[model samples]
Every structure is written in C-alpha cells, then in structure tokens.
Target: MNLYQNDDTTIQIDALNMLKLKKNILLKGPTGSGKTKLAETLRHELDRPMHSINCSVDLDAESLLGFKTIEIKGGESVITFVEGPVIQAMKQGHLLYIDEINMAKPETLPILNGVLDFRRTITNPFTGEVITADDNFAVIAAINVGYVGTLPMNEALKNRFVVIDMDYISGETLKNVIRTQTLLEDETLIEQLGKFNKDLITMAEQGQISEEASSIRALLDLCDLTTIMPVERAVKRAIVDKLEDDREQQAIINAMELTF
Candidate 1:
C-alpha cells in the first residue's frame, strides 16, 4: 500500500494543491504506475469518503448513475431507485474516483459533462432528478494511454481537470518499495529484482514486451512469490506466464536468466 516518493518528486503535494483549489485531477500514467494509489492517498489526506468507479468498455449509464431494483415491503413488491457512485459521491460531497477514465465507451462519457464542469450538476436519466453536487464534491480520474482497448479522451472532457503524469519508480525508490512490500530481506536479492524490473521496463518501452509484464505490481507479486518459491519459478508464474506470446515469454525468461 506504500507509494515510494523520491525527494525530487512533489506529486502528492501538487495533487493536493489542485484538489484544494476545487480543480478536478486527471492522472495520466502507464499501468501500475500508482495513479490509483495517488488518488487514494489524496482522498485519505483530504479526509473525504471516496466512491470509486472502474471504467471499462462495458461501463454503462446504469453503472454511473443508478439502477432500480424490486423489493418486497409489507408483502408487496416495490421498485426502489439505487444511486450510483456518481450520484452518491455528489450528494454526499465525497471524492469521486474514476479509474481508467479513458476505458469507458466514448458515447457513454458525455453524461458527465455537467457534473465535471463548472455546473457540478447531473440530471438522473432514470429518476428525472436534477442533483446538484455539494460544494466539497471533487473528482480524481486516472488513465493509461496507448494501452489496448483504451480510447482517446475527448478534448472537451480532458480540459476539465489538471493533468498529472506518473511514471515508474526506479533505483533506490523501487528497491525500497520491493523491500517494504515483500517478505524479502536480503539486500542483494532485492537489488537483483530491482535491476530485473528496470530491464523489463526497458524491454517494454522498446516494444519487446507488453507493459503489463513490466508493471511494478507484477514485480511485487514476483517478490512475494519468491518468499515461498524459487526466483526462477516465481518469474515464470508471476511475469512470464502472464503473457501468451511465446516470443514475449522467452524474452522474459532470457531476462530472468541474465538477471539471476
């Protein structure tokens, strides 16, 4: 749960400042780059309850707004309206977290135009209720650009927030993250794993491997597996086997061999 911050990086500070100014935040980063972690951190620091929505192509209006469900009351069936994350967060004046904002279908996102803008209001299509957000309601959205199945964010939608770019942790910061997150105690082994992660990241950047294989979350999983199994086996299960392509798997295996 820890996000290692280098001395030179003011990511958390800058993000807090933006939220304090009532500006929505758009976190742009590669997968597993701690965008969601950063959002959670800001929510905790601001002492606001957060309602999260994981965006994907399958996301729809019912998920964003609310749904109606039938229930029995006094032996009679009654239909009740359930508020979705967007409406709940607005009404409660809490933090609204939209993870992978660009993954939702393009046509579905226009529903948030008024909610994310200066108006801060959304008319519930299902209930025909015009809900105005509380003054303290804020938004924090994260995106992974250039990934498969992710759509380009509309510029009009993109212009509504302050954008922050998050990148992978490296060197001592990454080493510390591994040490803190895993049961690994040996400094030498931790350093080796850190180097291996950096190498995989390099390969991913060069298009030799997918970004998912180089993720810090995957690296953490590998480290945890090493506690119960051999590093080689851990690499195969945690990093290598996750990719279906033979060439990519072998590329990871080669890196593992070179590193170990």
Candidate 2:
C-alpha cells in the first residue's frame, strides 16, 4: 500500500492530496488503469484500515451485512455472528473498497443507499443493532464503463458519490511499471512493452477487439513472471489463456502478433 512516486518525472499520483477530499469519490475507467492500486496507495498515506469487497452479479444484501454461523464448541452448537466486509468496515472505520460496484445486483443498492446517506448505519439482522458508521469511515468504489452484462448502478445510489472519470494511464507510467515489475530492465524493451500495451488498450477502446482489454495488471504480471519463465509462455497462460474465447481475445492476439 506504501507506493511512493517511484520516479517523480513519470508517476502522476499524489496520494496525500487525494486523501484530503471530504466526500467519497467513484473511480471510473477502463480495465487495468491502476484504480485499485491508487486506492491502496491512498489508504496507506491516510493510515486508514481497509475492507474491500469485490462485487459480482451474485452479491446481495445478506452478503453486504453480517450472517449467522453455527459453530461446534465442546460438542455444542454455538451460534456466532459472522460479519461481511461492509459491516466490518463500518465497525472499524476502515476505507471500504467495493471493486466493480456496478456489477453488483440492482437489489443491493437499497442496502448501500442507507450506508451512503447521512443516516449512515447498517442493521445486523442477527444482532438487531442499527450500527452507525464511524466518523472516519470512507467508501471508495471502482467501476468500469461500457462493459456488457454489467448492471448499471441506480441513479439514487449514483447520486451519493462524487464520480471521477479516470484517464487511461500515460506511457511514462507504463514505463515506470515495466521497469519496476519486469525482469528485463532494458529501457528499450520496457518502453516497447509500454507502447504495445498502450496500443492494445487503444484497440479495445475503439471496439476493434473482445476479451477485457489489456490491463496494466496484464503487463505487470507478465513482467513479474517473465524472469522465472519464458515471456511467450508466461503471457499465454497469464493473459490469453485466462480470457474467454471472444472477439477481444482475437484482437489482443492480433495486437500481440504485431508487437512481438
């Protein structure tokens, strides 16, 4: 979480400046644009405890709040309280990160609505206590635009947050990532990979390709593994293989062919 501007000339983030905002901000961008990483960096700078939940189509209110659990202690059935990430965040005053918030079921919005408003409290069904949010509790949700099959967040829930449309990462940032993450420190290769990934991202933006567009994560993961294995094999497994067989995958493979 402690990420400094490793190179002042390249990295754009000033975590201290971001943590100073009064309201919770929704970070919107395309895939692999460093949204989560930025959140982690800011969390460290603010010295805030974090509780994150990755939202998918299946997430529901019960998933957001605490649930009932049965435990066997001394051969006796002991009913225990099991809290979800949201409830835990509320209790600890941690920075709650809901990754891909838009992907959560529409029904879940009502639960979030209560938490987001000034009457910030969550009711634990088991405990029967309407717990209030700690003064320091902050929500940082990340979302993607133009992803098919994702449920659009309801207007009411959206109204609660300050939306910040995030820009695609600059070439220099990619270079910095490459230099730090990849095994080959050759400035030429680092810049080359950055440009290649940038081109892939562009193709995805233009709707010229299918699997989720190449991410900063894809390049970083590739770089991290390439030192221990062949780059081609690493990319094949770490990226191409992970993607579903879709138009995006073809476009990405085509771009890779052109680049390397």
Candidate 3:
C-alpha cells in the first residue's frame, strides 16, 4: 500500500490515470502481465472496498448478479435473495474486479451490459429490483488473449470500456520487481531468470511451449524452490512438470538445456 513512484513508471500508472478519467477500462494482455495486481493497487489507492471475482466458464447471470438461498427465519424455511459480488460492489460503491472475464459465460456477460454503460443499472430478476449503480461503483475486467479455454468477449462488452493493453515489463523495471519480490540482490541470477522468462515466452509465442509453463508465478515459484533444492529439479517441478502435453514438455526441457 505504501508503494510510490518517483518517475511514475510501469503500465500500472497508465491504467490508474485512464480509469480516473474514464471510470471503466478493460485490461487486456498476456498472462502474468500483472493486471490483477494493478487492479488491487488501484483499489487501495481509491480506498474503496473491493469485491474480487475470479470468473469461470460456468459463471452465469444468476450466480454473478444474485441468487436465492434458503434461510430458516422461523419454523418454515424461506428463500432469501442474496447479492453476489457484482451487486454488492454496485450497491456499496466499491471496485468490482472481474479477473479473466473472458472466462465468464456468454449469457452471464449480458447481465453487466446495462451496468457498464450510461444506463448504469442492473435488473435483478429474482427481486425484480432495478439497482442503479452508485457514483463510486466501477468495473475493471482483465483478460488474457489466446489462453486455452478462454473465449473472446462479445463486442457489446468490449464497447463498454476503454481498452488498456498491459504486458510484461523489462530492463531495470523488471529487475526492481524481482529484487523486491524475491528479496535477493543477485543481479546475475535475476538477469538470467529474466532472459529465461523471455525465452520461455518466445517459445510460447512460437507454439513450442504453453504459456502456463512460463508465467511470472512459475518463475517466482522456481526461485522459491531453489532455496530448498537444486535449480534443475526446481525448474522441472515449478514449470516443466506442469505441462501435460509431451511435445510441450520436451520443448521446454530442450530450451532449459540450451539456456542453462
């Protein structure tokens, strides 16, 4: 929360400034691009309660907007309409962060159409309430392109936001994050890891490896594992072993051999 910038570097500042003016934005980028973290940073800066939702392919309007739950207030059970994260954020004027929004069901996305536009109200079919969004209520959805199992968001939804393209940072900026996150000042190791990550990403782009095997998370996990085991074993466990496809696994292993 105490994070500050002397030069206002990193794409995070761009997102903050854009959201300040537009109120809604779509953060579309590759995986491990820090989209979710950027959202959390903005949420803290705004000093608002955050309702985070990890969207799934199975998510529907009924589940996301609100749903009925049975409650026993008396001798008899009564159905109660409980608000979901979307409605809760709307009513309380909080930040509604939908992570990997493209994973959300197509039918579910229509429920948010009205809320994202000038007609900022969502109709709750269960309660028959047309809930108008609060002034402070904002939606920031993030999506990773070309990730397996992810579908393209409908044009209607894309029209609702000013798209912000986020991607991996580089040079000293990346090294700073590595030092801060890993708590290690080994420049040589950091540089090597950065090159390794870039190589992995290049492999993914060239259809030789899965992006899942080359995420920032995977690198951080590998770094953490190095403290307890050999780097080779750590690499296999943290990244290569995650790939289910034999060809993908072999390509990643071959790259590791060439790089290390």
Report the number of the highest-TM-score candidate: 1
| Tens digit per residue, CA lDDT, model 1, 1-260 | 34546467678888888888889999988986767767877888889999999999999999999999999999999999999999999999999999999999888988999999989999999989999999889999999989888999888899998888888878887787777767888888898998999899999989999999988779889989998999999999998888989999999999999999
Residue pairs of candidate 2 with colliding backbone atoms: 210-247, 210-248, 211-248, 211-249
Ranking, TM-score, top scorer first: 1, 3, 2
User: How does model 2 score by TM-score?
Assistant: 0.84
What is the C-alpha lDDT profile of model 3 across 1-260, one tens digit per residue?
22323255545666677666646778887876667667877887789888888889778776677789999896899999989998999899898988898888776788788888888898898899989988888889999888788887888988888877867655566566677667446677778777877888888778788767767778778776766776778789999888889998888777777767
Better of 1 and 3 by lDDT: 1
User: After superposing candidate 3, which stretches have Cα over 4 Å from the reference?
Assistant: 1-10
Any residue pairs clashing in model 3, and if so which?
Answer: none
Candidate 1 overall lDDT versus native: 0.89
lDDT digits (tens) for residues 1-260 of candidate 2: 22323444322243344435546668888777778877876687678989888888888766788688899999999998888888888888888898998898887767777788777787766688898988888888889887776888898989888766665665665676566546667676566667777887787677675425577777778767766776567667667877776766676677677777
Off by over 4 Å in 2: 1-22, 73-75, 181-184, 211-213, 244-254
**Top candidate (lDDT):** 1
Candidate 2 root-mean-square deviation in Å: 3.6
For each candidate, what is the lDDT?
0.89, 0.73, 0.78
Residue 211, candidate 1: Cα error in Å is 0.6
